[model samples]
Target: MKPPDARHSQAEDARLLTDQNELARQEALNGLRQFDAVVEMVEYHLQPEHRFRFRPSHLLHLHRLALEGISSYAGTWRPASIQIEGSRHQPAGAHRVPELIEELCDYVNDHWQECTPIHLAAYVMWRLNWIHPFTDGNGRTSRAASYLIPCLRAGYLLPGKQTIPDQISQNKKPYYEALEAADAAWSERGTVDLSAMENLLAELLARQLVEVLDHATGGHVTLPSAKENPSS
Candidate 1:
């Protein structure tokens, strides 16, 4: 059932960071905290007895970190419908968010062993954006969750100076294109064809790793093509 408060007014949901400059500063600070927290959480969950299980709470916690001082809606599912700018895809209704997020977690847990790290990460990134569960920080939370899944699956944090999330944020054209590709596939058929997104992750991950190697070797290292890296 749609909750009585499911139609939050735009004015009521206005951000706490009224100043654009302050908002940008907070975004930078919050992003650091969010990334550090994700790494720490990944380490904690890596313990043999404390295996990771993707849950709705995980997303909420990450969202909270991403928008703690920026939005009044931090740490919670959006209470009203939101429209994605520059795209035709409509987010799931506020009433459907909780169930959709639950299913997303289930998808990760159900295929934890079978899916490649890149595939799992790509799926999480795309699906969470598709769900658009939070009133704010959906992108931040989605990217954080995407990084978390692969780190947990691999049993350790992945190494890189610039992570997949970091790269995507720096220049989002390719990222948006990949997401659009997946959306088009879903519209054409009921399948989750994440090849484009998967490929994007694979490429960015390789670039990140190569940067690490270049720094480690003092610019005397040879790197393999992204396609050659089976780890992605």
Candidate 2:
């Protein structure tokens, strides 16, 4: 029985109520496609044959892309603002940027084996954004970075992983609201509570999961694919 809103948007309502297995399957595929697109945008390889094993070089390349594409400036890296609390604001030197980049890479490498791919992914992304390593595109870079976990996780856990930018970007009020909320819960130094960060990620992940499932399992999805991974 379709609900009153069901007929209006089949893609969205298709799986308003579906079995757990079917929902999981559809989401996997979406995750794969989105992850592939994002990585490809920055000339990163997916290595589908390997089931999306995350490579450091590729991940770094993707992060650079997000930093480049998402930032307001095309090819520069500096503090966008005083950074109310994004990361640190100690007048990072040009050379220091590379060092900071390494730190981020090292963090990912260190956690690659310790946490759930999703947990690692979410924390890295949130932390990266909070770090605001780049002057511009910090938002876009962070988002792309975040996708890595879900994308790879999907390959390992599900068939495909879909993009969640659309679901998350919706309603600027809630979008920014979530960001603000997460930021507040985060330590003044920008360090976040993993549990809180995970919860926030869970909401986005869960919503995207639904959208992916809705159209993924032989149904039509309503949310349009992110035209270009969000404007930043």
Among these predictions, the greatest TM-score belongs to 1
Residue 77, candidate 1: alpha-carbon lDDT: 85
* Candidate 1 segments exceeding 4 Å error: 1-12, 224-232
- Stretches off by above 4 angstroms in model 2 are 1-72, 79-95, 156-162, 172-192, 216-232
Of candidate 1, the 10-residue stretch with the lowest lDDT total is 1-10
- Residue 120's lDDT in candidate 1: 90
lDDT of 2 by residue, 178-209 (tens): 44444556546555556655666677777666
TM-scores of the candidates are 0.90, 0.55
The lDDT per prediction is 0.84, 0.50
Sequence-dependent TM-score of model 2: 0.55
Clashes of each: 0, 14
